[model samples]
Target chain A: MDATFRAMLEHGYNDLSIADIADEFEMSKSSLYYHYDSKDDLLVSFLSFASDRFEEDVLTAPTGDPMTDLEHVVEKLLPLELDEERRAIQTVMSELRSQAVTNAAFREQFTDIDDLLVAHLRVVVERGIEDGSFREVDSTRVAEHVVATLNGARVARATTNRTGAPAAVRVSLASYLDTVLRGRR
Target chain B: MDATFRAMLEHGYNDLSIADIADEFEMSKSSLYYHYDSKDDLLVSFLSFASDRFEEDVLTAPTGDPMTDLEHVVEKLLPLELDEERRAIQTVMSELRSQAVTNAAFREQFTDIDDLLVAHLRVVVERGIEDGSFREVDSTRVAEHVVATLNGARVARATTNRTGAPAAVRVSLASYLDTVLRGRR
Candidate 1:
């Protein structure tokens, strides 16, 4: 999986081939073929692997404070500074997401990932509302908006020359949380 | 350009070829080649064509009312109803945007499009603030947030099973406008 991810970041999704991944892998080409039938199959498996990692890393551990948890998720998804490694991962993810427009296998995995993120966000919002940290906003709607904005910021940061987008969104989201989500009482 | 658009929607970006475009074109494949050298050339041309259409349709002819003008841009970008035609176009755009991650030509075109949209949005926000329709806020930041959220909503609607995402974003954005942008006076 690490080999595939690294190879994908290096070669990109379209130019990447099984041979490239095999070269990156410690195992031989024959052994790689024995595991996965085709490039798409391997990529599909990679998506699943990435999804599991996302679930474990972003969703599993949440700080007790609902607001802090929400901020944590936002920071994980759209970090203000985006170091080289995280940028590479985001580039790979963006490439895969574009494929999801046409490929059902990629789409299915992305759907699951999207669902998990939104669900995690919804739960955090609900917790905030229940614990008096947040106002009485629609939790599902808030979750969707937060995810959508972060997704947009990530895309802009990766695909365009908008290097400051993630930071802009971070500041905007912080103000949004303070004014819109925070409870008066 | 019409033929290119139709052919892209029918065959998709990956499967699309000069022959397919020729089939959709009114003229001969030889004539099509006379205009463009390769499939990538034709696609780059198509992107410029689409960008012009978007600017003329969405950015021009704004209402005198700043708030109404803002809504007009948002509605055009993220309509509540994704009819068959609009959905197809959005899918194609999403595909092209994905390509931008790996392809420089596509990336350049998309960068222009993104800049145009953000600039138009910033002008609208500045207009609102000047005309006293909106509160004192950072016009550039507000514009970026609005565009990013819409972009995110569009991606979600295209790639995932989140059919209600556009509508949800529309509602959320409306509320955001009311609370955040609207002037107290």
Candidate 2:
């Protein structure tokens, strides 16, 4: 999985083949084929690993408040702390998003990941609603917006005109919470 | 421009090539070259045309109640009745957005189109603020969100994913505006 991720990140997902992955670890193509039938299997494996990492981060985050919890989700999405491996995960995830949109086979898994993220978001919002820390807002809608904002930030960071990275999303997220939550941190 | 737009919509920007556009219109390569220098130029022309269509809809829209007027702007983003051509334009737009993140050349032209879209949103938000139709919000930030959501919706529509279409965005837009406005629309 580590080797699969490294190659995908450095060269985009579409650009790699099974031989390339085997060659990276100095393994025969036949040897690599024993582990995974196809490139799609490799992609699915990488997504599973990545998804586990994201879930772990969400589960363990120290969110002081609902807003901070929301911020924590944003933090994970941004890929803020990075090495080549992290970059590859993010890049590969991006390609997966595009692929998911087009492939029904992948949609279920893509949605599963999206559901987890949204559920994580809903947890914070629901807690805020219960604690009177957040305004009376549709938690799902707000959660979707928050998710979209983070996704949107990925696109924003990609643009050459942008000065910063995903940190730009933090500013947008702050304003979004302020408007919807109305000053309850 | 039309041929390239159609090609990009059906096939993603990365999937199509300079020769594809030339073959579509039955024009010799050199003859097509007479009108435009490169593929990027052709892509830019399509963007400029889309920009014009957007401006025509928003700028010429009725300026009655700001909310009502803004609804018109929102409608422009939503494809009320999508013809084959309109869907093609939308698909191409999505491809542009996906690539703009990584390609400097695409980024430059995309930035111009983004500015125009943001300007339109800023005007509506400014009008809302002035008329007390919306709470005082950060106009630039809100404008950016509007653009982000618009782009996001375009992706959803192009994508085969069951969710994240322009229609979903329209539904979300209403709630999103309500969430942020903090006042009567």
Candidate 3:
């Protein structure tokens, strides 16, 4: 899985090959094929592995404060500055996401990740509302906004030259929370 | 350009070949090459064309009301039910956007589009603030959130099974405007 992830980062999903991975990892293609039938299968496994990592890294480390916990989630979701490997992985993920437009398996796995993020946001909003830390608002709607804005920030980071896009998102999200939870100015 | 757009929808940028596009369009590859040097050039031209269409279709039609004008921009930005052609164009755009991670040319073009969208949002926010319809806030920051959320919504639509992702974004954007513009709940 590590080999596949590393390989996919260098060679995008469309160009990723089992032989290349095998060669890079010093394994025979047949040996590699024994575990995964094709590149797509390897990518699927990679996606699953990524989801697990996200769960372990972000979902598990929850502070009691709903607002702070939500911030943690955002921080984990969008790294301050993606390193080389992180950027490569992100590029591959973007390719897989574009593929999801036609590929069902990719779509399902990506959807699972999306659902997980949105669900986490929803929980945080609901908790805040229940504890009176947040004003009464539609939890689901706010959750959707938060998730979408984060996703969009990722896109903006990848596509634009803007270095402060993530910080901007954080600022906007804080304002959003203030509007919803802290009431009017 | 129409031929290129249609072909790109079917075959993403990675797999797209000039021969395929030429064959599909009944144009000789040499003839196509005479105008555009590479697939990237063709794709770049297509991006410019798409930008013009967006300007013509959405930005040109502005209602007097800032709120309604903003909604028009949203409507034009995120088509509710993308037909086959629209979906194809969107998929192609997605692929090109991913390409921006590596290709400087694609990155510049994508950035221009992003700037255009953000500028539109900024204008609406400014107009609202000027007219006393919206509360005084950082127009630029709010515009960034609006653009990012919409981009995120597009990602969600592509990756998830959520059929109402566009509507969800619309609702979220409306809520954002309300929170910033409409005062307390």
Q: For model 2, report DockQ.
A: 0.38
Candidate 2 residue lDDT tens string, A1-185: 77777676666655778766776665566767898888777777667776787788664565558877877776667655557655555556666666654556555566666668767887888888888888877777777666666666666655436544355446666766776776532
Question: Each prediction's DockQ?
Answer: 0.74, 0.38, 0.75
Runs in model 2 lying further than 4 Å from the true structure: A26-28, A35-41, A59-65, A78-89, A164-169, A182-185, B26-29, B33-41, B57-62, B78-86, B153-172, B179-185
If both were scored by TM-score, which would come out higher, candidate 1 or candidate 2? 1
Which lDDT tens digits does candidate 1 get at residues A1-185?
99999899898887889989998999677989999987889999999999999999988676789988988898899887878888789989998888888888888888889889989999988998898888899988888888889989888886787777678878887877767787310
Give RMSD (Å) of candidate 2 vs. truth: 3.6
lDDT tens digits, residue span B78-153, model 1: 9888789898889888988888887789888888898899899889888888988888888778888898899999
Could you arrange the candidates by DockQ from highest to lowest?
Answer: 3, 1, 2
Deviation (Å) of A121 in candidate 3: 1.4
Name model 3 segments beyond 4 Å from true: A26-29, B26-29
What DockQ does candidate 3 have relative to the true complex?
0.75
Better of 2 and 3 by TM-score: 3
Candidate 3, which CAPRI tier?
A: medium
Per-residue CA lDDT of candidate 3, range B89-118, in tens?
677777778777777888888888888888
In model 2, state the lDDT of residue B119: 74
TM-score of each: 0.93, 0.81, 0.93
Q: What is the clash count of model 1?
A: 0
